[model samples]
Target: MGELDRAIADYDQIIELNPRGPSVYFYRGIVNARKDDHDRAVADYTQAMQLAHQDQRGSGDRKAQLQGQADDPAYASSADGQSIALASGDGIALRARGGAYAAKGDFDRAIADYDEAIRLNPRDKEAISARGNAYKTKGDFDRAIADYDQAAQLDARDARVYFHRARVYWQMASLAKSLTDLDQAIQLNPKNAYPVLWREIVARRSDQLSEAAKQLDATKWPAPIINLFLGTMTPEQVRSAADDADPVKKKGQVCEANFYVAERALQSGAKEEALKLFDLAAADCPKTFIEKQAADVELGLLRASR
Candidate 1:
């Protein structure tokens, strides 16, 4: 957390030096969002958008002036190049702000920003995938799938795109399709922990528990948390492992530990205990963490079913 604070302080000095610089604001927004300071993130993102628009308008004026001097082909070409670069930068700013809005749970605004970002840069796979996430959060699975498909077509080797698509399939209960996408994602990025974790989860959910166990046992994970999924370590041990000297790391680990314990309780038919554990994970975990998102999803599904 202190590292994030120091980074923000550095961005503050940069902003002070060049108040009109949009990129600094955008980066600061990301750092603030990661720190779970949603309001500050929104403020920085808003500033970034404002400055980016100002830059775009200035670039447009310059391009118009150069067009009036079309006799100078070199001037016109230079203006065109500048305009294209400015447009791309603006698209990036919009996408960054959209992510901040999504983190704040303002899906409508987030989608609007993403739409403009795509319009400005049609081949932006990152923006496409992010828009898909916004649609997924809104329960518009069809649109989410379409966006994910587009992103995959744009960048077939992007493991995150496949992972996002697999998540949507999982939500729709298309377990086989989900598994297929997960397999592709893992094949593309074998060392990525997210795909490995989700693959195990999908396998377990599909009643392929033994297969899940075998796969988990065969693979060496980067995080000790994988032991929880493999059933080699008890939930109590998982919680104990979270007892770290660093408060932030300890909080994150505890959140993950609670989530794994909740999954274990749910698998053992202890719904009440699982719900309690999910509550603890949700309450303690930072919103930026995948564990928090998973816990929220589990809690929502549990309540919906009840």
Candidate 2:
């Protein structure tokens, strides 16, 4: 928080000097978002979007074009070489604001922003997939599926869209479709054990656990988890195995261990144990992890049932 605040102060200095420049506002918006002040982030992004649009009419400079043109200064600061302006139009600011709106639980505004982002760049698979996730969270499953479908068609090899779509399928109880999407995701990104875990889970839901077990690697970082599901390892062993020399990876592994164990407990009809493990998983897992999201969903469902 200190570092983010310092960055925000630096951005404030820049904005003070160049109040009309959209780039500074755009960067500042991102910093505000990192600080979890999503409403403030939205305001900054809105200003950036307005300035960027104004730049199109030659009121502003070339450095402030939407998503910072090909030579935009914003791209120069990126660690992953991806410009916030992912497309040719005003997609960057829209997507940024959309993300802020989503973080603020304003799904309607988020969806509207995403809609414009998609219109500006139909090939922006990331934005489409994001919109799909928004729709899924809004419980408009059909719209989510449609967006995922478009995203898949736009980029057939993107493993993430398949993985996300599979989760939607799981929620809708379309077990077979979920399994199919998870299988595709696993095949495309074999190193991602989450897809493998989810595939096995969906398979178990469909009573095809034996077939899913056939696909387990049995020799990897998550091998302990696979062995647990296979009944070859105990929960204590899974927890022990989750510990690692690297604290970061260890935290994620432990979280995964708890979540997977919770799944097993649920499968065995041990609702109380499942709830306990899921609570642990939800608290331990990073907010960004799908495991955390699933744990929260499971907790909600279980409590609602009671």
Candidate 3:
């Protein structure tokens, strides 16, 4: 077994021995979350939180011991939110449970958890960013932008926050602001394909597509996508390159191809055709991919316009 698996096994044995041990449940939740088992992770965190709450009204030493469980290195899920992310000592379980809820497409509950987390620790920027993402998915762009603004003020180097804000601007049809945020995102994380891809797109809409090729650097997988935007590769070629031996990864790449191409078509004013491709993207994208959320947003926006 991998280290996380062995750790989980140990935690399982511990849980069997001391079923009421909140620390064991919490640590197991962390291991399970690292394994991408978000459901179990959420359950563990909930149980931990319950036990901690119950023990809080006890003797001074016991209360202190329970409070000591909060630590900066604690994490419940990943940034992609097929889980949660790292947190500081305050309200860790709530921050983590919010992530699990987001990963499960339960934005309202996620937002509630994030609200509590932020109330407990106003400087929890990761939870703030994840909350922004949840708001974005829920079609609450204004609130999403507000949260991202807070997160950026808290940590200017967070590339995904800029990316998230860029998408929000794109949604609002503020293409210039979207391009500006995408520029910041690319400047922060040059190798991230999402911002690079969207920068070309937003630039195209701004009639500045020509200089996009200057930003290109060749790489695997998404290199084909970059080439497609540069006019050096066709849609068919990009799709062909997206084909992979790993079925799960292949699904995401193909979803990206459809979404990007559909976006290009939308920019080119091919509304009906873009709708068809977007449908494919929405149906095919992995649940954890930000593009899947974007695809759903696109579909919603287009349908509302119709």
Candidate 4:
């Protein structure tokens, strides 16, 4: 956190030195977004877009000055390269601001931004994937899948797209399809623990516990929580592993731990206990965590069924 604060301070100095530099504002916006300061991130991204637009217009002497700077060996090798770089920067700014909007739950606005970013750079796999996420959040599953399909075609090796698409499949109750995508994602990026964790849940939900247990044995996941998932660690032990000094961290850990335990309880016919754990997870977990999102979804279905 201190490092991020110092980085922001440095960006401020750079902005002061080059007030018209869009890249500095864009980078600062990224930092602010990471800190969950969405409003500031939006403001900085807006400033970046405006600057990028002004740069694009080839404003009087500004274009000539930029071209001259490009001639410097320290900058770009040629003016054309610099122009391409500047144009790409605008697309990046749009996509980044779209992400901030998505984080704020303004899916409509986020989709609009992602659309424009894609228009500016048709080959932007990240923009396409982001648009899919916004569509998923809006419960437009078909459109989300379409975007994910396009993203996959654009970059077949991107594990994140597969992971996200798997989530949408899970939400759609296409457990078999979700499992396939999750399997592909894990195969592509074995080091990413998130896919492994979700795969275990999905496998169990699909009544493939034997397969899940086999896969779990072959893959080594980190920490007390993985032990909880394997039924080797108690809920109390999982809770103990959470950092007590940090309320937010503790809440996130406890939320995730309770969510997994709730799943186990549900499987064991302890419906009442499962409901209690789900309620605690939904109430205490950070909204940004995937576990909280799943918890909320589960709770909604539970209430609907009742």
Candidate 5:
């Protein structure tokens, strides 16, 4: 077992021995969260919070020899001596639960948890980012953008925030702004393929085709992205392009050739090949709006034939 797993097991044992031990529950929750068992983590945090609240109602300073009350002034101030404040652990747990719910596609619940987490700790960037992702999943792009903005401001070093904002911009059809954010994302993490692929696609669709093409060529665009474009090219043209000395350059030419092939197929009743290319393009450039549009066209044709 991992250290986190062992820690969680130890917490379980401690909790079993002392049901009202808020610290034990809190630590267990943290361990469970680290293990990605967010539901159980949430439960542990809630239990810790409840127990913590119950310990806070003492009339005057009274000491509890047990539960490690010596370090807590609030516990010492309580008359019954049973009271202790729940640490920031509850907030941490709520944030974790929100992220887990978001990952599971329960955006509404995730947002609710994030709301509570933010209420407890307003400056929690992780919670804010998780909420933003939930908002994006719900198609509330404006709210997502707002949260992502806050997250970026708070954690400027996080490339993911820029990447997410770029996605929102793309959704809103603010292509230039999207491209800008995508460029930042790529700058921060060159190995990330998403921004590079999407950026290239947006560049292709840009009104200033020559400038966009220049930028794309300068970037040394990936072969898969070039292949996706070439899937739309004409078969003969693709064959001729493949004869080029540089395979990388050939890929771009092939992409253009495939585009023509796919386009001509669509025009000449070769629906099958056209659909295949469309599917290929979508797979290679999922973030491209045009691929989705082409997918819609292919789907429409298929539906009509049925």
Candidate 6:
């Protein structure tokens, strides 16, 4: 906040001295961009580019570069001799434009600009990361993965790259890859809860019940959510598991009691009660077994009625 204020103050002074100066406006535009005022940033950048073009119209190197006759100064300090004074080698202008376009959801422009930035600086990991993120947002998982891969190769230690890659993998339904990337992200930044949540979802989807349960226990996950899974035990299975439990068993006894109630309801020809039990079984039973039990009960009822 303090930095932004200082930057704004500096921009104000520069703007006052050179009311039509592109460089001053460009500096201010950066501050607006940081604040997420993208519209104003775009306006400022446009104006800056125009002013730079006018400044460069007759200059030998700058004009030649604009005319495609020569290379633009890769590192020009003078805002006075070019339409845009952004460092050519670093592709700062292209990257900034790409980011601004992305902010506005103009992905085509963003990608084009990013392409230019990448061409200018093959090692611009920030541009690579931004482009990857843009592709992810556009639901182009393959492109996102490509960009993320390059970004990761450029800077393997960046946790954000791993996180974005995981998201792309998840979107592609590549569960193993998604989980692997998520685990890497977590290892790199354990404080981020996002990877943990994604990992939990993956665990559930994979039917790793014990692992999911342990994660829930270890992480202080909500009890109700855990119960949502456990509560799926069928009344019959609950009862059977409970009734045969040794005296040393605690939860099994309670499960058995619920099972008895469920079984009794089914025996009483209460279809709703039976279905409820089946639902509980679906939720609580092992993925390999519970699904069959639920399906069989449902199929039996359907066929009997027919």
What lDDT tens digits, residue by residue, belong to model 3 across residues 1-306? Answer: 237777888889998998887767877776666565778888998997777667745534443554564343443234244233334332667877777777667789889999998987798897898889888888899999999999999999989899999988988899989989998998888766778788776676433333543555677767787777767888888888898876546877899999888887887798998899999998877555777877887898889999
* Position 216, candidate 1: lDDT: 39
**lDDT by residue (tens digit), candidate 5, 46-67:** 7766776677643121123223
lDDT of 1 by residue, 1-306 (tens): 347788899999999999997657766776676666767877887887677667756745534542343453222211001111123545655676677777677889889988998998899777788889889878899999999999899889988889888988988899899999998987887666667777777777533333434443343322455666666777787788777876766787788888878877887889999999999998888654556767888999899888
lDDT of each: 0.72, 0.78, 0.76, 0.72, 0.58, 0.57
In candidate 2, stretches whose alpha carbon ends up further than 4 angstroms from where it belongs are: 1-3, 56-85, 205-258, 277-289, 300-306
Worst 10 residues of 3 by lDDT: 76-85
- lDDT value for model 5: 0.58
Q: Write the per-residue lDDT of candidate 4 for residues 43-156, one digit (tens) a residue.
A: 898997788678855543443544444443323311101111222435656777887787677778888988997897788787888888778877899999999999899889
Task: Give lDDT tens digits, candidate 2, residues 189-287.
Answer: 776666877877877743344345556566777888877877889999999999997665688899999999999999999999999999999888855
Q: Supply the TM-score for candidate 4.
A: 0.79
Distance (Å) between predicted and true CA of 279, model 2? 4.9
Candidate 2 TM-score to native: 0.73
Best-first order by lDDT: 2, 3, 1, 4, 5, 6
TM-score of each: 0.78, 0.73, 0.77, 0.79, 0.52, 0.53
Tens-digit lDDT string for candidate 6 (153-214): 98898887887788667656798998899888877876554455456555544243334444
Model 3 ranges off by over 4 Å: 1-14, 21-38, 54-90, 205-217, 243-248, 265-273, 286-288, 300-306
**Positional deviation of residue 225's Cα in model 6 after best superposition, in angstroms:** 14
For residue 151, model 1's alpha carbon misses the true position, in angstroms, by 0.6
| Cα RMSD for candidates in order | 8.2, 5.3, 4.4, 6.6, 13.2, 17.1
Candidate 1: worst-modelled 10 consecutive residues by lDDT: 76-85
Candidate number achieving the greatest lDDT relative to the actual structure: 2
